[model samples]
Target: MSSIYIHIPFCKQACHYCDFHFSTSMGKKDAMIQALIRELELRKDEFRDEVVDCIYFGGGTPSVLETEEITLLIQTVYTHYQVTTDPEITLEANPDDLSEAKIEALHASPINRLSIGVQSFFEEDLKLMNRAHNATEALQCIMLSRKRFQNISIDLIYGIPEMSTARWIQNIEQALALDVPHISAYALTVEPKTALEKFIKKGIIPPVEDEVAQAHHAILVERLEAEGYHNYEFSNFGKPGAFSQNNTAYWEGKSYIGIGPGAHSYDGKRRAWNVSNNPRYIKAISQDMLPQDVEELTLTDQYNEYVMTRLRTQKGVSLSEVQTLFGDKMHRYLLQQAQSHIEAHFLFQEADRLYVTKKGKFLSDGIAADLFMLNLFQHPFDQNSNQS
Candidate 1:
């Protein structure tokens, strides 16, 4: 099965820590949606050999779009692509946009999952992040969503400056109380050029402490695991049968078509992405011209990606699969690179699979980097190409 990610690159307000490609003024929302439909039609052959099982509406805030507009996109996908009998269609919404009426409308739409951006459920944290939603709106949205949508996920950021251990724990507790089946929690990093980065440079806010982040991460993993949520991926926790299909498909390196400004597409060997600028994308698509750049993944690029993505999952890296897919020389090189980490008790090898130990999971990025082959450096993902 394949997946589709539709990027809605518009937000009502910019979050201080966000460095995503989006415009605050949504004057071109309608034209952008139509452009997305055109792109979908034009790229209908993307996953032609597979059936689509997931369609994720990710964004600057997908909830910024009206339900009818979202439905139009879904209908476009159905019209142009071969989809599964029961597809997991998700929308990444913001608390401020998911009012009671909005929730009801979404319930009627084809969207079966709600991935809400409830970064934190505290007033101070909300204001600190410069989020559009208040603490009340955050709580209200999740509570309301719990009643209508069973497959719900919330995004929470830890490691914010001045976010006390007590407050972080409370945020976890509040999410648990809301009965969300999936939680995508991440450490707050000061992305370069973001408002938060500038704030720290100007001494307007304190920098994030790594030790504090590690501590918060421990709490998150422990609490969520105790509550029957599996830490399936480093930054993702899900209760039984609630893993994100869209994200899992991505982690497994399955083909997916991404539409909208700054969206990306991947086949087994090639990667392509649309223009990040909304006007450029809309103008190009209107004239039946493609607004995208393409890249071919070398064998080494594929191996590094495999190592990076697999190290984050519970399954870790598979030597047997590596042997078959990347051949024995690369597999041997990986094992050689990983030997030092294994000796340090950071990773464990069983039969043909290698997995990060609990102690090493917190530092998985470093461990994954350690396993990379020579000259296998990768370009950071283009910002707008992330998620929904």
Candidate 2:
């Protein structure tokens, strides 16, 4: 039930909208890799001797690392952690870094799943995003990866202002055409302090249109459904049994260990994150200290976390389970708060489970906020739910 995530903080180029803690320079790659391995060994017992079921390599571009470095990291993890016999080991890669040799090396490693960053399969889209790979590489890498890894997932972005509706459909079709089993699609957002934001502020790049993003989301759902993919999470689709176990563990409140700079870990009751700077993290680990911060979750914080996460998945929230976990008093309060959303058709209650309708899925975050047990200690009962 425990998972592990290792962040590889190096990228070939910076995406205009990326605010993730990654460096375009490869200067510190070697030191960072060694530091990650050291950190893994130092914190081997963080998971309470539970069998590790999932290990995910996420970040700047795990694909950019030399295959031997990755192999060493994997070997170090296995040497310390009690990994399961059939662990779901995933590596996040990018097309530009994927070569036949690289894929072969990955196949030889412990990695069983590949999550490639293929933001778009169109050349213009790639340029606008400032991605390192071109359209051809994006399309070809998936095909090549299928020969090496069967449990494959790719990342795709939608809602770019210049991207046409037809093009978005083409992206979905292309993904289907590649026979990819899983996909993580997301709507483009201009985060503050990112190049995309600066471009918009400087009037260099057009602002993202909400209407366009919503339309693309609708198209994505319809097309993927027709293609027989389950819309498991709001932005994730999988072909039966192919959901990312590592990510699912996160949503289900399972404990996990995270290594490397800017990585996060949650131990059911508390959450922690390492320092985001590579140099800082390396220096701390060298001194045998984990450069991280931790926070213990309060009861209200736990309830709100459950509501936010469960509402994002297709299964929704289970009233009985909520009652069992948070007690009957909290359960009744949740039902009272969810009443208006259920009445408004934004949320539906069936057989003790609550789910967001397709019409309301786009507004899920807003709805979740509205349904939050914010004033849990205040009301304790008889709360009025508003249909926002």
Candidate 3:
């Protein structure tokens, strides 16, 4: 199934760890919304033959928009494209934005899922990350959201410097107490040029240790699984029937259209991304021109991506599908690359699938890299956008 991702490039304040494109000023908010709608209209034909199963509002902070503005965007999609009878529409919101009134209004809208950015339920963690919401706001918002929405996901960050193991467990317990159906937890990595990196460099904040992150991940897996939450993807856990359709589609390599500035889109064979600059994106859309760069994936590129994404999921990589899609030569090459990992008990082959063991989950990305068939036809644009 196809999906649509709309990036709202405005936030109340910048999170220290964030490197994603966004602006703190809302001076051009209305203009950005219109530009997003116009981009959707311009790209509707790309999904003319495909039914849209998901419409995700990702940020900066999508919750910053009023319910009416959000409805208008969704209505635009319905007017221009084929949407399913019941699509999984998600809004990535911050706790401070999800006031009681806001939650009620959002519940009335077409948004069926709420992915709240409740990074931590501790005051210190919030302060360290410069999150817009405090611990109380985080707890209160989720409690309020549960009254209106059943399908909800909360983001939590682990591996914060000076976070003790007991404190991390308390964070998990706090989430479990909220009863949200999905949780997407990630380790805090200091991206270059971000305030997080700067703080660590200045010795103002302690360095984030990988060993600590790994330990936290182990606790996360053990605690969530004991509570019956499926670790569907490496960083995402969901109750049965509560998996994120939007993210699952992405992991399965389904085609999707990404609207707004800094958004990325992919068809089966080609990927495209709009300009990250808000002014430039608006100017181009206003002029009825698509301000985007496109990349045509080579066979090796496709295989590498497939391996990277599939290996992170519970479904693992299908060895037979690998051979079927690539060839006997590439398939044999993959087996050869994976042999060492399998020998180390980090990976195992059961029937036609190769799965990462619990011991190897934390190292999945590196393992996938080792198995990558380096592309000789590397596109220059790919150097910047190849992470996914």
lDDT of 3 by residue, 1-388 (tens): 9999999999999999999999999999999999999999999889989999999999899999999999999999999999999999999999999999999999999999999999999999999999999999999999999999999999999999999999999999999998999999999999999999999999999999999999999999999999999999999999999999999999999999999989999886889999999999999999999999999997778888999999999999999888777776677788989999999999999999999999999999999999998874432223332232
Q: Candidate 1 regions off by >4 Å?
A: 376-388
Give the candidates in order of lDDT, highest first. 3, 1, 2
Candidate 1: clashing residue pairs, number:
1
For every model shown, the clashing-pair count is: 1, 0, 0
Over 246-303, each residue of candidate 2 has an lDDT whose tens digit, in order, gives 8788877788999999999888788899999988999999899999999987767777
How big is the positional error of residue 367 in model 3, measured in Å on the Cα after superposition?
0.3
Candidate 2 clashes between residue pairs 3 or more apart in a chain or in different chains: none
Model 1 C-alpha lDDT versus the unseen true structure: 0.90
Model 2 bad stretches (over 4 Å):
375-388
